[model samples]
Target chain A: MSESRGPGRRPGRRPGVSDTRGQILTAARTIFAEKGFDKATIRGIARAAGVDPALVHHYFDTKEGVFIAAMRVPFDPAVIVPLLLNGPREEMGERLVRFILTVTADPQAREPVLALIRTAVTNEQAVAMIREFMTDALLGRAAAALGIPMLRMEAAFAQMFGMLMARYILRLEPMASADPEELIALVAPAIQRYVAP
Target chain B: MSESRGPGRRPGRRPGVSDTRGQILTAARTIFAEKGFDKATIRGIARAAGVDPALVHHYFDTKEGVFIAAMRVPFDPAVIVPLLLNGPREEMGERLVRFILTVTADPQAREPVLALIRTAVTNEQAVAMIREFMTDALLGRAAAALGIPMLRMEAAFAQMFGMLMARYILRLEPMASADPEELIALVAPAIQRYVAP
Candidate 1:
């Protein structure tokens, strides 16, 4: 596939002939917000962007890829995955919890993650996309690296997800207002039990 | 107040006063859905209901009260509070987890609670109302009965809340489909650490 390019770059409706990827992303975001993720399809997005469905696939590969690109989370899971994997196994819980707290401490930095969560709850497509991305790129890798079952990794993640929702969204007292260090100390052990090899 | 009431004839809008309460609830719900909890005021609800704002106050003491009534969950915290407090301290975690699972297992019963969670995320007023109700009626009583710190009880609750969100709302697998007994076994010890006397 990489050997087909010429110096003139033949401009036709064929794949890689035009740059309509950004337009498709914009259309996808609008449709996702209006109709939600599950109902919004590649064909609909392509129609909105005035492009062929094949072009959408050529650029983004899948709806999930378009979502991940559109959502644009503030940090890269790739970086966090390695950090969690390379850490001391015993202290992995604390490290992961602390990382979540640290990253989310700033309101602006936390918006994209929150938006993804909000969208996920409302849309099955978003849930599947997030779950796949999280499992394939981050949690699954960590579980394999630590030699723990995938279920255990998911449980630990579920707890942390709930904790974030309670603190940031529900604004429950003490849990919401507690020092991050204190919370890390309190919750890390529970997480440890789940993720520990 | 009791002295003012006659034997067969109670005075001053006793309980069923022209079905205004129900009307107010409907209006409050509409307004809350359209404008969210914080932005939807008692005056706005009264306006929507075509009643005087004073009538709204007489019917439901505050906006929080109106929101709670509008978002009426099927179960009563009063009943569950006694159950949790009266149970053996060691088994409180299992009892609470089981209770949450059992109640939420039914889709009809779970809808209001899920609605409350969805609304609370977007609206601070909803959060404050839910948090107060949870703390004052349920968690606070359990903490006092067990002689555990309120903060610890809150942390335990936060984890359970997160677990529910992950399983039901986020549809995170394994946690979503895990057998109740297995989940009880896995999470009870963690909950016990937070609530145990």
Candidate 2:
């Protein structure tokens, strides 16, 4: 949809919808960097983007949504949370392991996630952003939905996170070169214990 | 022990044992960085340090030992493998988790390990160095000693590695703040499965 343009229609006077969305994302990145995830508000991001707060909400439903968009994460919790919950409880671990490994198997999709992880390791601001988003939007929601303890969920996440580091970043073999099915078989049972009600 | 000082010896002529040890570590770091863990050799490191290869062997029993010294890893496989194997088979997981968390709890001891992990994520050479060292020195030894498959050992390590990332780097709460004993309770069983004969 196009924004109404005044008669003058100067190139800079009236921005398009995409332009506003881009502006919001850019502002979100800067604000997230400066203030981190906890302190960065939608209002502040909208103000920085020169847009109304309502517009920011229209584009991204919540702060977590905004962060995910700004970070260009390949998968969305909106999508992933349901996937985790929809499966039979016993198979949750297998699904989680398979989904993560399969999604990250593609280098193009994995780069942004890996980059964010690398940044989180070195930068406190990045860590804050990642921590809040992961806890609130991802792990918290999954744990609450499944009625599992938050600690268990975090532990499960940690296990998968480590496996990814081993497979992709560290390239530790057998883990690195093993077929996806093999890893799912080896790791799923352990993950099952973490998520079982 | 003091080295003999020949007549007309200058301050630089006869280095103390600690100084020579430091020189070897310095050279090991450079060589490992340049050639990665696999290509780097003890002879090459000794030659770079202007010492005999035999001296390098005398000081560091193996190339992995040189890497451990150069990296300032808080724990050594020489100590850890035995610990893992000496324990009751079922309790190995608990011991492993407790040991890792306890050692890394000290910020002073954890920094170098975390720094290495941070470096490994972004740098190809660092990844190679970590991969070879971990596969050969740590996981290989433990898997062989326990008579378990290498894949199982690597997976177990991956779980712990990821937990460390969550606790220390990501600082994801619950996992980050949970009592070490509590974690041992939750995680030990999964680890037991991996290491069990």
Whose TM-score is greatest here? Answer: 2
User: Largest lDDT belongs to which candidate?
Assistant: 2
How well is each residue in A118-163 modelled by candidate 2, as lDDT tens digits? 5576557667877888889889998998898999999898889889
Residue B67 in model 2: lDDT: 75
TM-score of 2: 0.69
Q: What DockQ does every candidate get? A: 0.41, 0.62
lDDT for each residue of candidate 2 in B97-127, tens digit (9 for 90 to 100):
8888888887645655665676576557567
Clashing pairs in 1: A162-B162
Task: Give me the runs in candidate 2 sitting further than 4 Å from their true place.
Answer: A1-67, A70-72, B1-72
Candidate 1 local lDDT, B1-197, one digit each (tens): 01222213433445345666776776676676555565679998887766689999998899878888876544366666676778687898898888888887865456556666666665555667777877787667777877888778877877787777877877766778899898888887788788873
Score every model by TM-score. 0.67, 0.69
Model 1 per-residue lDDT tens digits across residues A68-161: 8766543366666676778688898888889889888976446556666667665555677777777677667777877887778877877787
Worst 10 residues of 2 chain A by lDDT: A1-10
